[model samples]
Target: MDRRFANGTVNAAQTGSGPPLVLMHSLLSDRASFDRIVPTLSESFRVVVPELPGFGQSEAVSGGLAAVADRMAGAVDDLADGEDVIVLGNGYGGFVALQMAIRHPNIATRLVLADCGAAFSEPGREAFRAMAAASAAKGLAAITDVAMRRLFAPEFQQAHPDLMRDRREAFLKTDPGVFRAACEALAGLDLRPQLGQVKVPVLVVVGEYDEATPPPMSHELAAGLPQARLKIIAGCAHVPQLQAPQAFLSAVGDFLGRR
Candidate 1:
């Protein structure tokens, strides 16, 4: 949980026991974001959930994509102890996961991307920048309404008011600069060309109701790699890990069990 990395002290939580599996949360979210799903995953594998730079107590990457990706890779490499790793990244963390796969395909023995967009979604990019800009100027409250409604499925919001409250508070907790740079960098990434080089098995999970990165996006990511299995979960939105834990776990667990 406490170690020095990227030339600074990194403070994050690590748990479970089995093969090491690195967990990264979505944008505006941190390691604690997996509090609900950890119990399930911890049963099968050693889970390393870190507070990504500027998301929680962690620091931000000083440079751009190269810098951030390198910092992430370094953190993993340092803490990994040279063991094979299964990476599970959700949303923005999925972007980082993809980069990790491309940057070090050998280490990422298995990769799982949940609701991540490969090619830039025009509206999504615009929305990300707009929200980042809003948060930078007027603060988080500027775009609170849209973020609350769009982050989850309609049915989810209605069924779980308490979760929505927690999510909102978490969003506010994110450092604006990291959020902005990450969003901007993701909006500009095009990994379609590099995915073919990845030799690791990949699992693509998408929420049926994910308007942000819909089934088409998952299909697109799944299409790029020769070893990817795509699954679309019903009644779930962007964050299926929390919105539909059982179904989500079933999909991911089944894949991990096999490998």
Candidate 2:
């Protein structure tokens, strides 16, 4: 079922029972973002998929990356029962997960960052700014095409036309202001200098054809962290969990299961 902090700053979907495993969604996604893989993940651990502020049923909370991290850290604590837990984050969620590890050390016992990098390069920051500008000028409809292209490969887009339409509608429904604020946060974020502080084991997975955060970016992320390994899912784009579920599950399951 769903659980919300008394203050109402966080809302999460909790299931199963065992060592905690928290799954964080992408920027534009909700708790259901991990629905396809949750059953397998929950079989091994109590899985908590939290809908970050401004997404799904969760209410928006003010702040930048650090502030967002604090809210997510609180959710982690509420679910972990005082025990360190594994955190798996995709896209924007990955960014928040890194901030959690850096800002509130010891909260996460293991980290799996999917389709995300340590920091955005100059061009990447500009992309976020441009997206914010376009969205602000004409709402989410203006940027949905570009966002979709960046999130998926052309071949995949061509093959899954209906899914593309649904996702486009989903984007259009989100408040442009909230989406813009998130983009601005990404534009201003620079985590490269602090990667060394993340000592917990990390698994950095990137889609083979991710246009937004490419393999090179994931390589940079893996190289920066003190204890990190990289994995690339073939024939996949930005959303491996959706595009290559088996590969994604295998990578994450092996990492969490290994001694």
Q: Write the per-residue lDDT of candidate 1 for residues 1-259, one digit (tens) a residue.
A: 4454545545557777788888888885556667878887778777788777776667777776656666677777776787888888888888888887787767678889988857767777787778778788898777766666656876678889998888888888777778778767876778889888888899999988887676788899999887998989888877888887878888788887732
C-alpha TM-score for every candidate: 0.93, 0.95
Model 2, poorest ten-residue lDDT window?
A: 27-36
Clashes of 1: 0
What are the lDDT figures for the candidates, one per model?
0.77, 0.85
RMSD of 1: 1.9
Question: Could you give the C-alpha RMSD of every candidate to the true structure, in order shown?
Answer: 1.9, 1.6
